[model samples]
Target: MAKEYTVTPWEVHGDVDYNEIVKEFGTKEIDDSLLKKIEKYGKLHHFLRRKHFFAHRDLDIILKDYDKGKKFYLYTGRSPSGPIHLGHMIPWMFTKWLQDTFDAPLLFQIPDEEKFLFKNNLTMEESEKWATDNILDIIALGFDHKKTSIFKNTEYAKTMYPVAVEISKRITLSKAKAVFGYTNETNIGSIFYTAMQSVPAFLPSIREGEPTNCLIPYAIDQDPHFRITRDVAPKLGYPKPASINCKFLPSLKGDSKMSSSINETCIYAGDSPEEVSSKIRKYAFSGGRDTLKEHRKKGGNPNIDVAYQWLTYFEEDDKKLEQVYHAYKSGELLSGELKEICIETINKFLSTHQKARAKAESKVEKFMLRD
Candidate 1:
């Protein structure tokens, strides 16, 4: 029997099937018509074309508001249990594109309290440290300093708690358990954390005393949390936040999503070029035949190849990507060469990002949301 797969906000295991996940999550696929609608508002991002960001909720409605001169803000977050990995970058990269295209304000949350509640090894102090480190990475993405406001949930609790209480009133414990698979074993803080997550979606609207639409770009695993948020938005007289969901970036070992818990299977933002190359060369699961001669004869399967899959996210040029695809399928490009390409591409990205991250270290104060 095929191993059963599981996906949750706290844990992701087994290989995910995006098609099945979309159906299960009650999200609509981003179709051509919707793509055209989005293009009307802003440039169609390559992530949309490649289906990395494949599903959405109320995306059309958000655009409709934009057409009528109502603007939306961006909200997406990180749980700072550990250092961030390349997989963590996927949503933020797309978020940056959306921010630039729409010229939107962004609320970047580092939910350290959530991480502290969930991860056993992490203390509040440790989570705070990770949150600080994570903020540096977020700033490194080149978000507009003037419009971007970042806050660690614990640090800005004075501002976040009041709104979170209103959200908490609407969400029942039964609903939380059903959505998050919580049992009696779950702690009170963990249960209350969802309310904090929901606050950013409707926060700007609350502050503005008008309907400010929110667009949350995130992985599909996070859909359940926002589903609860959407449920309560109308009760509070705020518009339901719209979301664009992306598929999880595959692990180097060809398992489920790239995870911070599993160090060997993930490529971190801070990894040196040599470490990135070594990980890809040693750990990346290939879809080629065991023997080189056999691989040449039968060719490799890009569908199952980790290197090829990473390229979909990294390689933006359609023609160039197609060329690499054809070469691999025709046995003209060997596994080592493919790994080398992925390594080179990742290293190039890191070189620029690391420099930005270093600069961002000195600029963290500029992005924080104050009480």
Candidate 2:
């Protein structure tokens, strides 16, 4: 939520090409072997078997526990830096899906404390507003309140100091530096970020006085924190947390990642239909050439096209998405036409989510203060 620079699609991969990441680690293509293994030992639902989630570390163990009627909770946190965006929904959506399918308890943590550390002047009013907004957005993703728990770190920290101390004692500054690329110059607040993250992973068990297992669905960028969490889990007398690392969602401008800080780089959940249409027409990157004749003669660069990639993730109608891709690649579809389709699709999605969010907001306290 920290207002960072919106990167372009070319910059999304840094030195690596986007397609290479897709080929190597992206779950665009489902592997039969992996599917068979999961089907044999884990839930073989479409979301898992179809590779909607691509990479995981030790998730099989959590699934194995589930198969045996043991419980493993889901843990995911957010930094309340800004209004929720499309990038913000990825983890929550996947987590909600997992909760529904596995019937697991889900814990959602709002790292308002982390945001406060990064922005020292952040007021309690601002923190509460951001936390409330984020909760509404997450609930709109269709999580059941009965199975889901939400916490604000500022609230949790009142009695969680002991757990923080325990986590800090288990991890060293040297180890944190190595894992998080922290230099001697790194802020002390940032250095302690790992312990804050670790506390929530273990808090349920500490409060319940019973061991709890946790699984996190998060972006790969956050892997470092949980790596430390896993290492600290055993020493704290709890099971190590499992994780499923999702691929980064690319920006509409074809830059690094879709960010809400730059209005042109992303379509927000609150965007009006006209705003969505205008942004897509004006800012969405096009793979087609300036001239239709030239575009027809040469194939399009699907990798650089933002609309195509966005469709890959958002469009529920697989056949229609494929048709759009085929038409665009073959030069039968114009960039404007494709952009129009994306705008409509996104607008429809946002409209539904906004309505759902209103209902969710009414019951926010019920989930937040739950045992």
Candidate 3:
């Protein structure tokens, strides 16, 4: 029997089976043929080559349009409920590559209102503050301000509210409840939030007064919202937005996606090098044998080892990654040594990122779009 797991926008736990998710969500797997086709347009980023972005919907169609001289823009966003974590960086990093490769315009949405309404403990003020902080991290990734437009929901309400109303009318309460698992106790704002989320996918097409293709790079958990959006797109006379979905970056504790709720399991972008080192050493779950003799005889299982698993995302060089994988599997590398490598890699990345984030303090206005 297959392992049982749960994956939702608000919650992710258990041993996630990506194949099951793709099948259940009714999305097509990104096959080798698609990767070759993508390479013809622009350099295939390592993420695509490695299948980190493993599943997609209508990607081939979007590329088909691109080949025929029809250009498509990109849309991806963050819900600023807390500080940005390393897991949060995964999609954005890949999105940045897409922007560069395609030379496409990007709209980064900060759905502060959605987050504030959904999380009881989060105040509007807090969500806005987090939104500002989150934007800084996004900017640090070096998105072109000239081609990128960032906006918080509340700030862009005048533009979005009218579109949202049109969507809300099309989606019935029954549909919303089924898609989002909403209960009668669920807030009115929360039910209405999906419509707001759907607006960006169709917003560009409406503004241009032409059918504009849109590609959304997101995690698999966010599929339901877009499923609703895809259904309503034809009704609104817009081309359905296409999306590429990535697997979750696992938590340090193992078998779970990294989340902000568990501070120990997550590595925040703002975390100090010392903190990164400390967390990996103290908490990252290991897949090594208990004793040295046993470890040498049995070898480490990289499949369950958090440190080795993380390297798959962080280490871009395939040759280097293979060396590490084999070294650990043969017990030539100890668990502590593997953790040290991860510590060094993450700390090095964050050290440079922190500097960019600090510099981003002044550049925020360049990316923000509003009245």
Candidate 4:
């Protein structure tokens, strides 16, 4: 039986079966044929080669439109509730590759309001602070300011609210309830939020005063919101937005959440080497045998090892990653040894990233989209 799992905009957990998700969500799998087509434009990103971004809705159409000399833009965003973690970066990194590869403009939305409405204790001001913090990390990823427009939903309300109003008109209460599983007690703000999420898909067309194609690169949990966006696009004289969806990065604790407050559950992009080391050594689930003798004889299971799984997301050197995988499976690398490599890799990445984030502080105004 497939493992019990859930994928919603607010929550993602369990041993998610992507194949089942694609079937249930009515999305097309990102097959080799699609990969080959994408590879022709430029070198295929590892997210595609590794199949981390494994499902799509009309991705082929986006490419075909590009070939016909009708350009498309990219749209993706974050709901800034807390510190950005490694799991959150999975789709952003892929979205960065998409922006670079296509030379396309990006509508990067930071929907601060979503979190405030969803989290009872999180105030609007707190969410806005997190949005600013999240934007710095996103900028650190090297997304071009010229091609990227980052906006917090509240600050961009003048432009977004009117568009959201149009979208809200078409989506009935029953549709919202059915799509999101909303209950009687679900707040008015939360119910109306999907329309706000849908606004960016129509932004380009409205801005250019012409029909525009949009491609959204996002994680699978965010797919339901886009399903509604795509449904309403055609009626509004815009092409349905195409999307490529990625899998979540697993927690250090294995099948669980990466709460920002818990150092052991997830690795924040801003974490220091000591914190990273502690988390990996103390919490990262191991696939090795319990005893040294048993480990040497039976070897390790790299497939289930949390440290090795993280490498699949962050370790870009294909040959080196393969070496580590085989070394662990053959017992040449013990669980501690594998965790050490992971710790080193993450710390190296963050050292460079933190410096870039610091520099991004001066460049925020250049990227922000406002009145």
Rank the models by lDDT, top first. Answer: 3, 1, 4, 2
lDDT accuracy of residue 146 in candidate 1: 91
lDDT of 4 at 261: 58
Q: What pairs collide in candidate 4? A: none
Candidate 3's C-alpha runs over 4 A off are 1-3
TM-score of each: 0.97, 0.87, 0.98, 0.97
Worst 10-residue lDDT window, candidate 4:
255-264
Clashing pairs in model 1, backbone N/Cα/C closer than 3 A: none
> What is the Cα-based lDDT of residue 6 in candidate 4?
87
Per-residue lDDT of model 2, residues 9-63, tens digit only: 1123443243344443322333576567656644654345435466676677776
lDDT tens digits by residue: candidate 3, 27-130: 99999998999999677877787788999999999989988889999999999999999899999999999899888999999999987888889999999899
Instruction: Please give, for residues 63-112, the per-residue lDDT of candidate 4 as tens digits.
Output: 98899998888999989978888888888888888888888999999998
Between 3 and 4, whose lDDT is larger? 3
Worst 10 residues of 2 by lDDT: 3-12
